[model samples]
Structures are given as structure tokens and as C-alpha cells.
Target chain A: MNLKIEKVAIDGVLVRMPYNPAFCADEDKTLLHGGVLTALLDSVFGLANFVAIDGISSMATLDLRVDYLRPAKSRADVMVRAECIRQTRHIAFNSGRIWFDEPDQAEVARGAASFALTRGEVSIFDAMTQSRSSK
Target chain B: MTPDLATQQLRKVPFFQFLDFTITELAETHAAATMPFAERLIGNPIMEYYHGGIIASFMEAVAAISVSHGPDLQPPKPINLTVDYLRPAVKGALMAEATVTRKGKRMASVRTACWQDDDSRPVAEGLYHFLLV
Candidate 1:
């Protein structure tokens, strides 16, 4: 199935993935929560992996070291910049940063990640069926 | 599993281990996980929202539990984690949801969101990666 991917440009690299409020508070007028932020960063990192790595494979997060430079300003459109630094046999390393509309100046969060790649069975059915109801 | 087992596993995680954090789930998985906040977590102003580091810990916890739900994700560990702070988390319980994005033998990804119950909006959003290692 085609994932609903969202794209935003930054520093010459094109970052794309599906990122929506999914659950934002109307009163606060802010994004859903910190877990959602983590999910977004994870998505960008995965998209980087999907782009850098080919074929069907299962990967896990070895380390996702993130530093919150600043809390996102209220009611701002946030964008992430992800890059695959290096990919090796059975292991891939990458890093990326996110910012609100202000690309050069403001930063929402920054992180570095590593993934172990291996040939294994993956069920697309399970991926699609897991949380469609919850959404 | 039991709380002790979960604590042991959570401690092994590099990021979790870094913070000296232990798992305190108000409820079981496939539902809701309420993680209590500690004093050490506040990096910024003490009275304001929780420190970003604390928020990251919460995101990581959600991701761990989310991917662990998958049968094949035995000995699941984080590969990547990205966090976005939407707002400040004041003094209170932090709520989160860890959703599995993909699960393969080699690697699996999960998404999680964190928020305070009172505001209804999340303080941060995160994506967690778990490698079979």
C-alpha cells in the first residue's frame, strides 16, 4: 500500500513522510504531544532508511540520541531534515534535525540514529491492520 | 511480563539507562501507559514544562512497548528516535501511545505521542526504531 507521505524542503535535501497532528489540542493550539514528536522524528529517520536501503528488510532502532534544542513555538508548521550518513553491511547510521518554519534560525529538535539491517520476513498485512482502527 | 522484568529490560536500553529511569506503567500495553515524572528530568525551569530530556525518555518508553507488542520483535531495541516538542509539560502525569510502524526480522519501527491529560494536546511527538539486536 502507498503510505501518505508529506514533503517539506530544507537545506537542499528533500524530506518526505506522513506527519499530521492526528491528535492536537484545540485550546492549546499545538501539536498532539511529545510522543507524536518522537513518532515524526522516527518517521523521518525511517524514510531516510527506506530511501537509503533497498529490498524488503526488517530493521530496529539501536540508538536514537536526540537533543531538544528548544520547544516548538506554538502553532507553527514543523519540518524535519534527515540524511543517511552511512550504510554498511547489516548496519546503517544516519542523523537528522527538525525545525519549525524558520529553517536556518530555529530548531525544534535534533537527533542521530543507527539501525541494523537484516534479511527477514515482513508482513504488510500486519503493518496495515495494526492501528487503522485507532486512527 | 512483570514490572521487574520490564524494569530490567528498560534499564538495558542505552537512552533509558542514560537517564537512570525505571518503567512505571499505570496500565498494561494495547491500552495506555502513564509514566510518572521525576525531579531529575527537569532540565529547563523546574516549575515550567518538563525538560526536553525527560520528554525524550517518555517517547523512548512508548516506542519500546509499542514494538515489543509484535511477536517477532523479540529482544527489541531502539535504532532511532526523533522527537518534536509541541509545548511544555507542567507538573503531572505524562500520557503516551506507542504504535508500531513496521515489524520485520531485521528491523522494526514504532511511532509514539506524549501529552498531558489536562491539555488534550501532546507536548511532543516521536518515532522510535528497534533493531532485532
Candidate 2:
């Protein structure tokens, strides 16, 4: 749950996670699990949408497509940079790539996702606030 | 791969372990699994809905398991995966069923569906393509 935020810009945000045993596949501990990379891409894409919409609405992923380009090396930090490519009244389109160790590094995976926007409702920021207050 | 080997492979996946996914059934062309509800798996903590990515991961795991148990007897590497979220997954156990639609020398396709309580209403569905190398 400790996702390190590396940078936040108008276009996108960069997030990173350190390699951990909990994130490795059993078949190959030396490689990061594909599911973990998928989750990271999803999270970063959502965050990018949040930034693009200025936290005005809540969004949910409608569909996501991920292509695995390469296996992530274990004991390295995985980084994802996602941006909101476009937005409509009801949907936000996002694209992102995941890499190990550095931003300019070769990508481990690339993904695209669409999120449904819920207008005039509790947003993801609100949920985070509520979660923090309840703790 | 045999059913037992497929199960062992599932156990080896760290994300599966993190989600506490259990393989319920395994066969040549079909596979099934279950994920028990846990607070850590929640995406919207306030709404207590399961994470969309986790649901996708579950479906992908099932698809991979089905292909692994097929005639190839080797776990295929994922080439691509597409997941559709049909409904918000509430706090409860989730079930997934997957079937290999086509199998070839180099590639295979698998479709998977996940439902919480009602099988008719799926929470998520996905198509996975794998490279059998």
C-alpha cells in the first residue's frame, strides 16, 4: 500500500514501488508478477485522471487493456507514468507505461484504460479523506 | 500440466498469494477459482468495493490456469489482457471461471468471468491472449 509518488505534473504523475517478495510470482521470484504491474498501471492511470479532472468527480475503470512487453526484474523499483490522453463528459482515456529503475528505461508493460466519471458525487479525493479520518 | 501442478503454479504467484486466491477447479480446458473478501483488497475504502485491477488479476489467473492445464502442459506467458468491469464488486467472496477458447502452436486465447454472489451478474469479464513458448 505504500506507493511512492515520484513526481506530479500537469500531464501525468509518476509512481514507484520497490520490489518485494509479496509482489513476485511464485513460478519466478526473480521476476515481478504481471498482476502487480497491472495494478500499478491501473492506480497510476486513475491518479492521472484525478489530476486531469482536478478532483471534481469520482471515476471508475470501465475497461483496461495491458500488453506485457518484458518481465520486470526483481529487487528493482518499478515505476509507472500515466497521463490522461483525453476526456469526454462521461469518460476519461488514459495511457501509461511501466519500467524498472528509471523513467527512461525500457518499458516492462504498456496499457490503456477508460474510466467512467461520476459527476456531483463523492470523488476519489473525498474517499481518501474519509479513509484518513476513519483511521 | 496436471491439475496439481497448475494449483502449485497458482500458489507460486505472489499477487495471488497477496489476494489470497484459491484454485477451486482445474481441468484440460476449464478452470475456476475463488477470492475471499478482505479489507486490503478494497479499492474504494468508503464504498468497500474490490479493486478493479484485482478483479482483472483474478480473471487473468484463472485464464492462465486453464491454459496451463491444457495439452501443452506448460504455463503460457501472457501476451495481452483486456478486462471489462461490468459491476462494482462488493465485499464478499468472488468466483471466477475461465475456458480456453482456442489453442494453437504459438498462441492461445482464454475468456474468463468473475461473479460475486450471482453467476448471472458478472462483476468482471476478460479475454487473455498468451504465447505458448
Which candidate ranks first by lDDT, i.e. highest?
2
Give per-residue CA lDDT, model 2, range B1-133, as digits (tens): 5555556666656767788887788877898888899998888776789988888877887888888764435567888899999999999999999999998989999999999889999988999999988
Candidate 1 chain B: 10-residue stretch with minimal lDDT: B23-32
lDDT per residue for candidate 2 within A1-135, as digits (tens), equals 578888987689999887788877655577776777787888888888877876456778899999999766656788899999998888999999988886558888999999998877657677796779888
Report the C-alpha lDDT of model 1 over A16-134, residue by residue, as the tens digit.
33333332312243543343445456556656775666652555455556655554434555666777788887777777776665445576667777766655465322343454555
Residue B64 shift from truth in candidate 1, angstroms:
17
Whole-model Cα lDDT of every candidate shown, in order: 0.56, 0.83
CAPRI quality level assigned to candidate 1 from its DockQ score: incorrect
Error of 1 at A17 (Å): 7.3
Off by over 4 Å in 1: A1-13, A16-27, A102-105, A120-135, B1-133
| Proportion of true contacts reproduced by candidate 2 | 0.69
Would you list the clashing residue pairs of candidate 2? A26-B12, A26-B13, B1-B73
State which candidate has the highest DockQ: 2
Model 2 residue B40 lDDT?
84
